[model samples]
Target: MNLSPALQQAIKEISSSQGISPEQFIVQTLTEKIGKLKQSNQTSVSQTGLKERDGILVFETESLNGIDFNELIAQSRQERDLEQMGL
Candidate 1:
């Protein structure tokens, strides 16, 4: 395959500096990239049962009932003033 002159020069420089041939460097790099692609494809978000809605991913898990954020914040403020929390 034909490569750009700049890319060829860069590959030659890096390979020579690392004491490896250009062909070896290219093969190792391509092998690493292909391995990463295969690994990513094997563990996709679809496999994890996460649904995408309006560009946000939602995961189904145990219900989160009786969780009140406002009450938690108010309790935290009271604790901070009374106990000097997190000091």
Candidate 2:
């Protein structure tokens, strides 16, 4: 793969700032992007019962294992607020 000179420079700068080699940075970035793509494709938007209601996105999956998403979000919000308050 060929990268533009400016992009190469930007990658070098970012990788150096992050204390990693340019190749390592590229590999890590590509790995993260591929993982997200795989995860997004794994969910069937049409047949998986995905919906948006009241600004919240909901989806049906067997992985939930009977957990309540609303309660989980509430707990996460509480934890985030506590962390913000330096708890």
Candidate 3:
């Protein structure tokens, strides 16, 4: 879509060095990014302590041990505030 001139120049130089057209390079990069995102999503789902029972998704109680709910909430709020402030 409308890439800046600097980005286009960088892509042109990189693709030329790798002996490929800029369009092919962009396609390859995008494909790799999509593959990584898909793989990450799949792994995250499996790693989460969640399971389906009686048509409902529930977290395993044992997996909740030692978690500091207050600390987590505080950290989440801090992060949200920082994000809102564009830090």
What tens-digit string does per-residue lDDT give for candidate 1 at 39-80? Answer: 886578668867678988887666668779899999989988
Candidate 3 deviant stretches above 4 angstroms: 49-87
RMSD of each: 7.6, 12.6, 9.5
Better of 2 and 3 by lDDT: 3
Q: Which tens-of-lDDT digit does each residue in 1-87 have in candidate 2?
A: 799999999999999999999999999999999999877865655467876679877875668678999999999999999999999
The alpha-carbon root-mean-square deviation between model 2 and the true structure, to one decimal in Å, is 12.6
Worst 10 residues of 1 by lDDT: 41-50
Candidate number with the higher lDDT (1 or 2): 2
Q: What are the lDDT scores of the predictions, listed in order?
A: 0.87, 0.88, 0.90
* Candidate with the larger TM-score of 1 and 2: 1
Residues 24-75, candidate 3: write the lDDT tens digits.
9999999999999988875776689666679887776676678999999999
Angstrom error at residue 52, model 1: 22
**Clashing pairs in model 3, backbone N/Cα/C closer than 3 A:** none
TM-score of each: 0.52, 0.51, 0.57
